[model samples]
Target: METKNINIPAHGSNVLRADIPAEYKWHVQDIYADEAAWQAACAEFKALLPQLEALKGSITSAQGLYNALHLQDKMSQMLDKLYAYPRLQQDADNTDQHLQAIAGEAEALAAAFSSANSFIEPEMLGLGKEKVAAMLAELPELAEYKFYVENLLRITDHILSADKEAIFAQSRLATGTAASAFRSLVSADMEFPPITDGEGKPAIVSEGNYMLNMTSPDRELRKNSFRGLMGTYHKYRNTLATTLTGSARTAYFYASVHNYKDTLESCLAEDNIPTSLYDGLIQTVHDNFAPLHEYIQLKKDVLGYDEFHPYDLYMPLSKAADSFACTFPEACAKVEEALAPLGEDYIATLHKGLTEGWIDIYENKGKRSGAYSWGVYGVHPFVLLNYQQRYSSISTLAHEMGHALHSYYSSMNQTYVNSEYTIFCAEVASTTNENLLLEYTLQRANDEQKIYLLNQFLEAVRTTVYRQVQFAEFEKFIHGEITAGRSLQAEKLENYWLESNRQYYGPALTVDQELASEWSRIPHFYTPFYVYKYATGYSAATAFSSAILSGAPDAVEKYLGFLKAGGSDYSLNILKNAGVDLNTPQPVTVTLQKFA
Candidate 1:
């Protein structure tokens, strides 16, 4: 039977941004009172640029170094406000050319600020280790920046000469074009063929609804959407191949230039992650493939499908069961209930933020898809959502709130330099919220809801854990191939992706030729070695959340400490303090046991 196409029009497709209710929108005005105020602030920030620039070549004394560091921090704080305001405005309605222009100007201003300050690092390194240490001793204020000082001295070899660093700073845009080009292709240029729904209605295939289509109970429609989407990617294989290959090479380029052994090392070094941690994640997933394969087979049995295809992966076994939908207020209330273990203060803060304009809750025309918790140092965290009243949406709400609260706590507790969390730890908080919501719901659910919850958990593990590991492995493979002087041709990438899928999905699923083009669609590939963190973070979160739900003493406290710690410590160290070690496979093993 043909599957009925679900028509959940992406929120931003038809409505005016202004028409969205004020209660449902984010109040960015708190960041800057108005455009005039933002403009005035921008002027002041521009005036301070030369002041920061003047400190270059004069770091011989402690006071001079202290002044430069403080001025730089102040400028950065102002620039965050300047950059975030328009950027959020543009994201609210990307079709607005005025807002887009403003966003562009903000970006350019940031780039210019970065370029102007590029001399600081190189010149500081040039001052020689003895001089820098002596200055630190001479100026006791520098003691607060002890971590910053040691980190700089540690990477002295990677710090380029002033001219080289300046020239390299100017090349950021050109180097980033591959990813930008891929985004434009998929989001703006590529189009999928319309597929008829099971209701005998025509449904447009879009990035927004393609996954929703995949979850259709009707087999034919799922096949159609799958084919339609992947087929489009197949058509643009060459262009995408060039983009992917270029991006992979770009990662290698940056790593080689900086004297790292490979791109993974280069990327992970920012958070002090060792290459063994990355490798251990992949190895652990391989060891735990039994649970994943067993789950896939269970899916086939539950759905009564004699043959399972890649297209059949998303739908639950019982299609006719009652599905979940909640209003925005309902979802918020549920979130508050699910996170009750975290104490009243945490929930109250989240509630205040939600009601007091910290969330942009609905979709409007030209609004960005997906959700995120975004904020600057001096402001409260803001969440962006294209919230549809589905169960996943509730989980998304929880997830983003997880991020928002993490930012809130970190900002309240840490210095500006340390307030921002690394991406490695960032996903942990979000996924932990998801685990809590799942567990809380399961606790009160009937048999039907229990089944649905289990299915949802499995699907989450599959996508975030298995699928992400596949991507990560694919990244490692391509990077290895590229670094070894193998050309990243389209066919080569497709084969690598195909093998990764087969390994991850196992013998129960059919691996088709069209699936080969899947690599072209992942935006993360452009970022290089980033997808692995999703798997690692999700695994770590599952462990942390389970501990908290078990009511272990200090579990919630340790998790909260993890959030507040932010970049104050390296990511693994933060996780270690919170009670999971990614360097070992225990978290991965414990996470998989949940599936078994």
Candidate 2:
């Protein structure tokens, strides 16, 4: 536990609203070098809009289609570059009007693409499945476009008419505007309680520091932080519930209007994911409930408690005690050292991420809650963290930087249209690096660090794989109710969530009444049954990490291929190409057995 005083509150907006934060945030001068340069690029980006719209209806035959695809590719590349500048800049400073202007530029870009995307899908659907198949089989250049088109057509049944599509497209921004605003406000504005330490109340507890507080061996501090945190949440629960409810209803409404069966199918269609993959993850977790129970039992044994509490779950077992004694700075240094096994290039990239301002280390006022890795095309991935120098904080660096590296590779190799991979596979890259970092630590670390590493690894799996699966199951359970013509009331939701928690944790632990209100606590449920990937991806990543560590030939090559593949292929098939099959229940089963 190498302790270092990081000026977190000064770290500013780095943690808050970073999804829209491009990592390579240039200054106003850096972007334009002066007003003239920014203006010129803005004008150039604007010009592409009219040109792209004209090409949409003009392309029907092979040559025309080829030209259109080329144009689309070029346009996308330019937009990626153009958008990266302002958004990245804005993310760094919320008060910058120029950055806000750049952010506002997205509306126009999105609106322009609406016409083009609506045109391409319907036109391809009109070409019929036969034409699409023949084109894919014949032309290598057209292979990616064909896959894109085929998937578009596959969801054609869910698509509305041209007029409706345009309306749908335009409304996309407005539809989620309030919810998007709420997400920003909630994460950015919600106040956290200040924490009291032995001497005095030193830390101004924020979401970032809350985790560290929960792990404090000091029981009063831990309970104070946890209770203070939940108390803050309690004050805003109604506002949050309404905001989230509106978001969920909007999601539900859009799927229904689009002729889709449900929000789950609609989300899967958006990324070309199969529903079977989603269901398979849920079903796999269902079968592995025993392992989850066993983990809880082990956790109880490790904590020396016959009855488990939520806070005790994160506490170190007997051996891990020594590891936490190291200061926070020591942990950061070790993170760099432990991650050295990822090849020279990968290590340098991680180092670059650390040294470069790619990471905005520490918490600050109005910063977003939690951790995330984000960057646009043609930029190094930047991660925003409200970091406390704990062992888990180092683990977080490993996890988030994994995502940054993955995006760095993918965006470098693929065009923007295909560059963005789906969330299903997103979890793997991050978790795989985490797994690697942990293994490296256990091998090289001192006894304290080893126990710390072990505890950290277990917690990572528990959170990413088991807990996420549990959340996924609960999410789906509620959606199932919606499917069965049931309404989701707050009381009913609380009951359902607590019931699910009871089942997951087993009858051994006391289920606190406050935990029943946990349904309102999770922001991911508003994402429409989206938590399962954390489970599935971690499972797949665990296997991938094990394989790579075994000195398997081409392991790195295949792993790199998986990162670079992006949305060029569906996530599952891409993972198969990389190695790890989620279709069989084995991946999750194997991950569970590791706990044994």
Candidate 3:
């Protein structure tokens, strides 16, 4: 594959989607050649819904069980393709009403399929464990489904009746209302006032450029941007608080219905993660805040500030290398070179993904913000990136490609039923790539570049591990409040936010009032109990990257095995097999020590 020089557009440019070169866009056509083919596939998928419904009561025998699961898997794979095509189209340019409507239709189709197949679990559980065991023993083909069947049996106490299960599945479409409204308010409706840029000129602030403004070398811009963004959220604080509370209430409702102890337990139950692990993470971080506080003090002293504030957190310590930039091709080459420890095949596949249509590489007007890697089972994973010519964008490229390759390796090695890994394990692959990239870059840097790179690395740890754990702690608090029958009012939420920041950053930083409203802007809060995984993932990645970089025997192979293991087993078992255990606080402790 030949690499070409692809020039990235200036930051904040408004180029239209059509203007982006074809070579830079992901090939959604690979999923379906055109919309006509997508319609045909959708029709065929709808036609097979009744076949799945027909097998509802016939799962008594091993052959019947295998047949039902096989049909479900087939339709699932089809639906995945059906869903990815239009969704990818819409993500490319959300301003297209036609694409949006079709994406909605695909989403509804997915919901309908989920509702139709809701009976399988209840019906399977209706067969006693003894009977299921007997059926498995009787049929050889059931070997593939042994884990799926046993997992359902394992959660037998939580499995509802067929009618209730179907109702629950249907309710999912409505249950997302809170999250949907939150997204609309933050992404579409909310607006930030213009702030002074580092150049003493007017600059607009939006969700996309807010971080860019925060990292500006100009102290006034960072301060104004922080206030402008958070002040906007503060204005809508009541509504935002209601939406967050609604989500927490919804989580509490589901946990109660499922007979779980709390929302945290219910959220972690899907992957069978222990609640102790979550609590231990917070405890470990609480015990090890010295390094984080020390870093804060170091930054404050280096910046020559009388006092550090929330806005001062992201400024780089080294000003000399502040203008560092790289083009898209340069970023890709750097990522590929940085990832060479994974051996020839991994690098070769990564090169293919970079050159081929697997990546949509530039930002366009109405294009989705941020970066992600997503794909259907049979297709190569596709990455969506608003590639900017900065070191952070290069790091993001490495992070997202890590996810893509994880999905790639998993799909290549595992059956469809087991190919999708849990969110718990997903971040480990991405952050491992990030750690490796940072290490590789640091090794080859000059003194000034080393200062810049070290600043970036420490800041990544501060935000990814320390700051995320702060968010996780607050998340747990809100959910616990709801579980204990309290309202998540705006004032209470703000107070907790302020206090948590104070505690996490310590005496070096002054927690501003505007910073209190920061919680309202985090979209992750809508997805309850999700942020801690970022911290844990970073810690686990630190462990894996350290071992691999140290030339530990079999480390690369074991890490690759973890990626390929996918959802074949529980998340903890997979990480444990790869030689990092999150059950103990050792990984988190070691990560903090590294930061120190």
Native-vs-model 1 lDDT? 0.82
Q: What C-alpha lDDT values do all the predictions have?
A: 0.82, 0.69, 0.86
Ordered from best to worst lDDT, the candidate numbers read 3, 1, 2
Model number with the top TM-score: 3
Give me the displacement of residue 245 in model 1, in angstroms.
Answer: 2.8
Question: Per-residue error at 182 for model 3, in Å?
Answer: 2.0
Error of 1 at 563 (Å): 1.2
The digit string of per-residue lDDT tens for model 3 on 59-117 reads 87888888888898999999999889998887787667798788878988888898889
Pairs that clash in candidate 1:
3-198, 3-218, 4-198, 12-364, 12-365
lDDT of 2: 0.69
lDDT of 2 by residue, 414-515 (tens): 766678888888889888878887787778678766767776767776778778888877766666666666666666776776788788777655666566
* Candidate 3 residue runs with Cα over 4 Å from true position: 1-6, 10-13, 320-323
